[model samples]
Target: MIDADDVRRIALSLPETVEKEAWRMPTFRVAGRMYLTVPDDETSIAVRCPRHEREELMAAEPEKFWVPPHEASSAWVRVRLAALEDLAELRDVVVDSWRQAAPDRLREAHPALVPGAEAAGGR
Candidate 1:
């Protein structure tokens, strides 16, 4: 399961990144765009997801994921590591969150990160 340290490491893995304490958590941003949040009290994390994909993701993994309290429907989802055992999948989700928050121009320049991400396809 992914922990706060894991989240910190992953967030720092991306280029031009910084961690700021916001929303009572460690918020990770790239060029001022937020992608991930390290929870203050748990191993779970809040990630920026495509608004359109939020419901689908919650439905698919209701236990492991949820639209964070007060932030549901705002393109943010909180994922609990307790139920999600696959760290690789979590890594992908975190990366995708970073992709969403990244500027379109950067996404284009770094197409290798999120393959087909800027091609207007897949989650």
Candidate 2:
């Protein structure tokens, strides 16, 4: 199962990503925009998930995802580390969130990191 360290490793691996601690938790950001956070002692991770897809994701994987009350109005979801299927899934989630927060320039430069792009290759 993925743990806080795994989260740290995966997040920092993203282009232009950085990790900072706030409120006693690790938050991951791309180009100064936060995209992921490990809270509650790193038991789970909060990641960007557009409002349109958040509900469906939670419904489809109730055991793996949820929205913290404070973040309900925001486009974000929390994932239970212990529920993640594997490292590949974690990487996909992290990369997706990174794409959402990454600036246009960063995303464009890292075309392979983006899901659908002319330069798309592999991360």
Candidate 3:
């Protein structure tokens, strides 16, 4: 099953990503902007997501996505690791979040990391 370690591995593989401690948990950042966090339990993760998309994701897949009340106003979503289909899916989600936090220069340099890039002949 996908787990926190998988999240860590995939996140760290991104360009300019760093692991930092915040709120007593591990937060992954790109260009100094946090994009993913593994909470204390390590069963799920919080990742950058626009509020509109987050709501749509949660509504479409309640078992896999959600946000706590305290973070309701934040543009982030919590994903249950166990609900992921495989490492590839985990990588996709992590990379998407990484892109959100990554600076424009980095994103431009790493076009392969952008969602749907492979199908569009990127990389």
Index of the highest-TM-score prediction = 3
Give one digit per residue, the lDDT tens place, for model 2 in 1-95. Answer: 68888888878988888998878878999888999998886789999999889999999999999998899999999999889888777878888
Ranking by TM-score: 3, 2, 1
Instruction: Highest lDDT: give the candidate number.
Output: 3
What's the residue-level lDDT of 120 in candidate 1?
Answer: 24
Q: What's the true lDDT of residue 101 in model 1? A: 84
Compared with the true structure, model 2 gives a TM-score of 0.90
Question: What's the TM-score of each model vs. the native?
Answer: 0.83, 0.90, 0.92
Cα lDDT, all candidates: 0.75, 0.84, 0.87
Clashes of each: 0, 0, 0
Q: Regarding TM-score, does 1 or 2 come out ahead?
A: 2
lDDT of 3: 0.87
Error of 1 at 64 (Å): 1.1
Candidate 1 deviant stretches above 4 angstroms: 115-123
